[model samples]
Target: MNRELVLAPPLAPPRWYRLRRQLRDAVLALPRYAALLLFGAFTVFPFWWATAAALSSDGAGIWIFPAAFLPNDPGLRWFGRVFYEMPFWRYFGNSLLISTATTLLVLLLTIPCAYALSRMAFRGRNALFVLLLVTLMVPAEVAIVPNFITCAQLGLLDSYVAVVLPNVAGAFGVFLMRQAFQDTPAEVLDAARVDGAGEFGVMCRVAVPMARPMIATLAVFTFVAAWNDYLWPAVVLKERLKMPLAVGIFNDLTGPFAVSTNLVMAAIVLSVIPVVGAFALTQRFFLSGGGLVRR
Candidate 1:
């Protein structure tokens, strides 16, 4: 005779048990999700308000109490006034030129500088890096007076060079690019060298392609900064024609008469469109791992 043992049936979760688990998770995550949504709404509300103001009529008085979320009578009349009443197109073109030139020059200078700092073993490398880092801590306000004096001495006052030259050797761009270049795989660089590729060849064929994301990031940042710059351009450019859009807008808006809030809003909306477009076009690189060159 053999003794046999029978196994009990496996216990399955009750229907209410799954529902309870989901409820517990939802309760735990509710605060965090609510906070995130609140923050997003807070950040986005200003842009919505600005867009509404831009589309509103002159003497709309939307900025007053009991502000309307959407304009009652929306029109593009303010934008038309901005364009036709002022030299808006000329200022826009000047800003575009200065920003583009500054971005290009900064990229050209910073990329090689970052590559050298990141990849090469050389004397004073650590010291140089430390110095560069220190400069970032220094405020631009401290240097503005000296910069202006130098611009005057060089007779570069009122010139585009005065605005663009100061930004070409940006500390932040160099730092960002250095981090990007350092992330590149060493083996790939070594392979290029083993194949008799020179430093320049390796940089062109391997480093640049991998660093596309970082470069695009840098370009966007530099372009935005240069585009929105007002203080330096105002100090350097005495002539109305020589001034960038930022300073030009200030000059036009704050004349003897009261400034039209709607028109100013319209100008701001117009100014931001190009930067938004640029960011949208280049933003994919930030996620695509296009900047990181691997072996």
Candidate 2:
């Protein structure tokens, strides 16, 4: 059998075809670029407005026709005033203390509980976890009165301990840490056990180091949640000195003080810095730690 060979057409495109192809590529890319820029601007505009208003000389004054996003007079005086005029440092210290204590307690309680729940098997384990999930559905407000009575009975009102203890181990923290531990490899855990490691040792040595990223993520989240907590702290702590920054600002910055809207803006900015900075510093762990393997 014999077959005839056929000549192939030229593979290269003509110049106009190439230019039209390039134009099509550019057109397809335009919407993505436009969406990104629009999203970025929308996200950034609020921060800019808050910052500009915080620095404006007439922050509390009526708006002018030609609005300026950047203040004509930028000053640090409000920052100083925030500290000096309003028992700000005391509130700051209280917030710092309560938030730190809460985060630590959360880590201490969550790590072991989550690790055990994830790694160990016992009777009613599923039921217990389900119960915890049920508790999450119970709105925090429902517990406030009972918690208040308990705090009163324990003589913990007006104290940092009152604020810190009730919120120390949240359902979300447990769920998050549990998910993180589950992502860890079972083989790694088995090897640790084979190497003379007890259950506690295995968890501390193998599981925790592997989940550092998740832990850091949880720590930042817990700290911020506690730092921003207002209702519970307000109910427990009557004294202004004992109040966290949230309640302190709401209480002292109003009525007699009437918390200048600009000063309030400054306070809001100051409050946000720590949370943003914490996430920025630990975001690598948060992003990278979400894998399903040791490597």
Candidate 3:
């Protein structure tokens, strides 16, 4: 009787069972996946359109009227005009210098300040953070008058110093650094201390490495903000030669008898390349979180 017993191989779930599970997963994912795709397209389409427009010929009527999604005759003619007809290179260089300097100085100041705020517990620390948050809520226009007056008093008007100095110690950078530093493990710091490392040594060796992602993120933010800044430079810098690319580009767009749309688009393309290149280069740091000031 025991030898007579037989078994059938386990059959795959009834086709409907497998189908039902797949259907459930698809249903659950549909809205989220759809939303993500839609948002991505929304954000990216304008840049694609801009690139398309930049490649089109001047006075060609491709971008006018109803606006062409694809150019009729794509050429580098506008790009040529950007370089040959305008001081495009000079403005680009000035923007690069200002943005680079601002980013470097902000990093130097914010890293230490954030470490102090995060690691060193003291009176008014929370208050200081709260004050910064409050300041963030207030529009930049609120402070522009006083800032302008101060710059004038310092005899910094129409100078690079006027543009770069005001932005050196940025509230946003300090806030970002502080938040990032707070996430560093206390045990790690204690171990460093046990190894006879001083505060600065521990910060360089331990804290900085852990906060690299946040730092890269901060750098991207600062670089974009500085590069796109127009009002401050326009207000402070009266001379055309001293103006940053943003102001210069705006002047090119609005100051002429009839704006060359192609040249303006070319300038736009040129202004964007640096930021895009920078993001592409430093974006690796964002993923690796590698540049911690380690021992």
Give me the overall lDDT of model 2. Answer: 0.83
- Candidate 1 vs 3: which has more lDDT: 1
**Per-residue lDDT of 1-295 in model 2, one digit per residue for the tens?**
8999999987999899999999999999999899989999999877777677778767744244236577747887777777877887787889889989999999999999999889999998878888888898989899999999999999988888889889887778888889989989999999989988999999999999989878887898888888899899989888777888889888877855574777777777777777788778766664333542223
lDDT by residue for model 1 (149-257), tens: 9988999988999999887997899899999889899999999999999998898899988888788889999999999999889888999987788999889888832
TM-score of each: 0.89, 0.85, 0.86
- Which rank order by TM-score, best down to worst? 1, 3, 2
Query: Predicted candidate 2: what Cα RMSD to the true structure?
Result: 4.5
Q: Order of candidates by lDDT, top first?
A: 1, 3, 2
**TM-score for candidate 1:** 0.89
Best by lDDT: 1
User: Best candidate, TM-score-wise?
Assistant: 1
Root mean square deviation (Cα) for candidate 1: 4.2
Q: Which stretches of candidate 3 lie over 4 Å from their true place?
A: 1-20, 58-60, 63-67, 284-295
Q: Give the better candidate number (1 or 2) by lDDT.
A: 1
